[model samples]
Target: MSDPITPLAKANIPNPKDGEIVAVAEDIWWIKMPLPFRLNHVNLYVLLADDGLTVIDTGIYSDHIAQCWDALLAAPPFTDHPIRRIVVTHYHPDHIGYAHSLSERTGAEVLMSQIEHEKSMALTTLDDVAFADMMIKRYRMFGFDQDILNALAERGNHYSDKMTKTPDAGYIQAGDRLTSLSGDWHIRCDRGHSEHHIGLYDPARRIYLSGDFLLPRITPNIATPLAAAVDDMLGHYFAYLAEMLTWGDDWLVLPGHDWAFHAVSTRAAGLIRHHQQRLAQLLDHADHAPLTVKSAMDALFPMELNEHERYFASGEAHAHLYHLVKQNAMICAPDQHGVDYYELR
Candidate 1:
């Protein structure tokens, strides 16, 4: 089947260059920071109000980005108003990495969902070797070879090494409302990409602060959750995308990565169809033979991948296979040789 996913279009505004802040709205500013990956930037926002500025998702901690932040903070709006709250949408390194440092420097309250805050704390508490061992165990179950597993383990805590420790934070839950001069943002929570990811919506402004939950271009990574690797994570992702279809097309999405974009409902529909096609692709392949996560990953991503990409690809493949299992459309057909497969009947 033809994949419904296409290159999602961005809003007709200039994307901010690295370290340069652009005005997203009358009182909101956009700061794009460079990342050391293929998708090489993250979008952070500052919401201005009479009381102070509210930062939404601090960029990952890097000397260059930190220096940029220090210089930006020392200037006009921030210097005068000061930051009152640092709202983190999730616990991803790129999202919450600089939260602790920014809060320390600006005396801003770092606010995150209780589940996300706990996950952040766990990341800081777990040492590199321990986290790497966890990865090895998880990937081993996904049918990765020992040699690749060892290589991946050496990359140890790549997520944690990028940032400072998380500070104590206040919690925000689903249905919570944060009212300010910026607008009345109604907090909505969704899971799949992460255990509990938060998005803020302001109907009046027609804006959605979609923190990796609804990226315009690509579907967010729906990997196995750390707590339960076998859970049907992709199912949760599907449900969230279905919910987005009801949100109407008025939103100007401020995503965690990529430039701002319009048409929330369109993007959501495309993403949902994208996942459905992927699941069908796997099921069709399984009709020929029993499928393992490795086989599915290869079929889904028909390209040569480096070590990190391979690991992520495996996780995404596993999520889909397990989702099929959860829906009773497939059954696990494990081999005693320390690898697992699934058969779609």
Candidate 2:
């Protein structure tokens, strides 16, 4: 079940530098903003509206990025047209980080799904110490060592640092049609990567602004945030992938990261296979021996991980284990140490 890994190649869209805006499609501008992470950048889009421009996602809030926005707003095409509304795809810090700032600066309305808005509001007002304590408990349940718990407790408001305040937002839902500057855009609420993540599709143009639900080269990280405590994150992810597979193959998927791609069906299938293989390995390991989430993660993700990445790795390991338990492929019990152990059913 351990399939050989093949690198995914993106479509022929050039990588844009920080503060650079590239015209990826007609009347659509791709703006890249820097993130202080390995992924490094998020793609924000600008769609030409009738009298002004509508922004897709706002980059993380920072003075440096603010200067970039100032420059962009003062530039030729942007100067001629003001930003009227800002629509965010999800509640991720990078996507909605600067939404409030931009809305306040330009008096632009913020639009997002109701669940995402509620989750974002929850995250923005989270108590750091209490959240860290909760994370420690979750990690302990997943069999994380005391060292990891200490590191997590010392993490010190890391999540809040990346985000600004969430603004008053209007709600969007699945099957809703939003009339934008381009045309009527259909909203699709996809879960898994984030709760109720919204992706906009333009039937006339065959274009989909897919956010984190579908990326060009990499599968989005599925973590169990306190705001979203679903045990079946991968299940939700696969459901979304299967749904995307039914979409027409000619769609130009404008992802939150990486280049815009034409083969979403192919990408979705590849991601599905990847997860299926992971689940197979997980099942095989559990069949051989009862294991904790930490042991399972060690077997599944062999690469070395930093303290921050450990959080996602543990959550993803729990996700797979939870999926197996839900499917009755595995059974779980608490060990003497009060940690969960899973074995094949």
Best model number under TM-score: 1
| lDDT against the true structure, each candidate | 0.82, 0.81
Model 2, CA-based lDDT: 0.81
Pairs clashing within candidate 1: none
Please write out the lDDT profile of model 2 over residues 1-345, one tens digit for every residue. Answer: 123444346667666788888876666888988877777889998888677788999988888778888888888557778888799999888899889989998999999999999988877787778768777877888898898889877885566677678889988899988665566788899878877899998999888899988776667876555655655777889898898788846888888987788877877888898889889999888778898989988987888888766767777788888888888888889888779999988
lDDT of prediction 1: 0.82
Best by lDDT: 1
TM-score of each: 0.94, 0.93
Once fitted onto the true fold, the runs of candidate 1 whose alpha carbons sit more than 4 angstroms away are 1-4, 227-229
